[model samples]
Target: MPFVLYLLGLAVFAQGMSEFMLSGLIPDIARDLQVSVPAAGALTSAFAVGMVVGAPLMALLSRRWSRRTALLFFLTVFLLVHVAGALTTSYPLLLVTRVVAALANAGFLAVALSTAAALAPPGAKGRAASVLVGGITLACVAGVPGGALLGQLWGWRSAFWAVALLSVPALFAILARVPAGAGDASGTGVRAELRALRAPRAVLTLLLGALVNGATFCAFTYLAPLVTEVAGLGEGWVPGVLALFGAGAFLGSAAGGRLADRGPVGPLLAAGAVLSAGWVLFAVAAPHPVALPVLAFVQGVLSFAVGSALISRVLYEATGAPNLAGASATAAFNVGAALGPWLGGIAIAASLGYRSPPAVSAVLSALALVVAVAAARVGRPGAVVVEPTR
Candidate 1:
C-alpha cells in the first residue's frame, strides 16, 4: 500500500472518531442536555441522516473535481463544525452541527474510498478498501475509548474539542500527501452514472449493504446501555469493553480483507451466518459478566467482517460507474446507521429491555444472510458475477 492510503486512512480515522464517539457520550449528553436517553441516542441517527443526504449531493457537486480536492473541502467543513458543536449550548444547535459535520464526513468518506480504490495497484482493491475502512476500526480501538475517557473526565463537549484539534493535523496530511487529481470520474457522466446505479442488480447490492450495516448498528447503538445496565458493569468499564469490541473489529477487517480480495460473496455468506448466531448468543448471555466481553468481541468481528465484504460487493456491482459506487455504498451504510438506532430506540422506549436490541439485530442479520444467499443464487448459471478488480 502507498503512503497516501495511510494518509487517507488517517483522514478517515479523524472523521470517524467524531461519528463513533457518540455511542460513549450519549449518557452524558442525555444527562447534560436534560433529555431522555432515547432522545440523546437520536443524535447518532441525525449524523447518519446527514450522511444519507450528503453523500449523493457531494457526489453530484464534486463530479467535476478530483477526490483530493473534494476531500480537503469536506474536511474543512468538518473541522469548523466540530468547533461549533463544542461551543453550542443548546441541544438543537448541537444537533445542527452534528448534521453538518456528517454532511462533510459523507463527502470525505465517499471520495476517500473512491480515491483509495483508484490508488491501489491492480488486484489490491480489497486491501486498499480495508486500509481505508481500517480507519474506522482503528478509531474504535483508540479514538472512541479515548474520547469516552476524555468526556468522562472533562465533559462531553470536551470530546468535540478534542476531535476538532485532531482534524487540523489530518487536514494538513491530506493537503501534503493525497495526490492531486486522484479519483476523478473514469468515463461516466452524471446521467450515465445515475443510469448505472439505477440498474436492478446494483440497487439490490446497495440494499444488501444497507441491511448488513443496519443490523450491526441496531445492537451497537445501544451497546453502552447494554453494558452498564444489563451486564451491571461500572461506568468505568464501558470504555474497556468498547476497546475490546474495537480490537475484535480490527481483526475482522484484516481477515475480511484477505477473504474479500479473493471475492466478497463467500465471506459475506459466512459472516452473515455467524453474525446471526452471534447476536442470538449475545442477547442470551450479555447479562452474565463472564460472557459479556467474549460476546461483544464476537459480535464486533462478525459485524465488521460483513461490512468489508459489503463494500467490495457494492464496488463489484457498480463496475459501469465505478466513481459513483463508493458514494452509493456510503449512502447505503448511513441509511442503515440512521434506521438501526431509530428502530432500536423505539424498542427501548417500549420497555423491551436492553436485550431487545440484540434480538432485533438477530432478525436483521438473518435478513442480510437471506439477501447474501439470494445474491449468490442470482449469480448462478449464465448470470454475470462482477468480482472486484483484482
Candidate 2:
C-alpha cells in the first residue's frame, strides 16, 4: 500500500473529528455565545446540511483538477474555517464557519475516496476503502473524546484551534506524498456521471449504503441516553461504552475490507441480516446492564462491517463515473445521517423509550438488506466493468 493512502486517512481523521466533536461542545458554545442550547446545536445541523449538499457539488467543480490540488484546496479551506470559527465571537459567524468547514470536509472526503481506490492494487480496492473508513472509526475512538477534554480544560474554542492545527500535518503530507496528476478526471463530464448514477445496480447500491447508514445512526445518535436511562449506567460509563463501540467499529472495518475483496454482495447480505437481528436483540435487552453494553459493541461491529463494504460496493457499482462515485457515496451516507436521527427523534417524541431507536434501526437495516438483495440480482448478469482511476 502507498503511504499516501494513510495520509488521506489522516486527513479524514481531522474532518471526522470536526464532524462529531460538536456534540460535546454545544453546551459550552451556547453559554459563551449567549444563545439557547438548541440554537447552538443548530451548528451541528448546519454542518450536516453542508456535507449533504457539498460533496457532489465540490466533486463536480473539481472533477478536472488533480486529486492533489483538490485535496490541498479543501484542507486549506477547512483549516482556515476552524481558525475563523475559533476566533469569532458572533454566533451567526460561528455557524457560517461550521457550514464552510463541513463543505471543505465533504469535498476532501469525496476526493480522498477515489484517490485511495485509484492508488490501491487491483483486487485490493476494498482494503483501500477500509483504510479511509478506519480513520473515521479511529476518530470516534480518540478524537471526539480528546476534543471534549480540550473543551473541558481550555474551552470549546481551543478544540476548534486543535482541529485547525491537526489539519496542518495532513496538508503537508498531501503536498509531499500525493502524486501531482493523480485523480485527474478522464474528461467524463457531469452528464456522464449523472447517467452512471441512473443505472439500476448503481442506484440500488447507493440506496443500500444509505439505508445501512441510516440504521446505524438511528441507534448511535441515541446511545448515550440508552446507556444512562435504560441500562442504568451513570454518566461516567457513557464514554467507556462509546469507546467500546468505536473499538468494535475499527475491527469491523478491517474485517469487512477483507470480505469485500472477494465479493461485496454475500458479506453484505449476511452482515445485514445479523445486524438487523442484533438491533432487535439490543432493544429487547436494553434494560440488562450486561446485555446492553455487549449488544452495543456487537451492533457496532455489524453496522460498520456493512458500512465499510457498502463504501467499496458503491465505487464498484459506479465505476463508469470514477470521479463522481465517491461524492455520490458521501452524499448517500450523509443523507442517511440526517434522516436516521430525525426518525429516531420521532420515536422518542412519541414517548417511546430509548430502546425504540434500536427498534427503528432494525427496520432500517432490514430495508437495507432488501436493497442489497436487489442490487446483487441486478449486478449478477451485466455488471459494469470499468477500472477505478484518478
Model 2 TM-score is: 0.88
TM-scores, each model vs. reference: 0.95, 0.88
Tens digits of per-residue lDDT for model 2 on 338-370? 667667767877788778989999999898777
Prediction 1 global C-alpha lDDT: 0.82
The 10-residue segment of model 2 with minimum total lDDT is 381-390
lDDT (C-alpha, whole model) for all candidates: 0.82, 0.79
Q: What is the C-alpha RMSD of each candidate to the true structure, in Å?
A: 2.1, 3.4
Superposed model 2: Cα runs more than 4 Å off: 23-45, 87-94, 152-156, 374-390
Candidate 2 clash pair list:
183-390
* lDDT at 349, model 2: 71
**Best candidate (score: TM-score):** 1
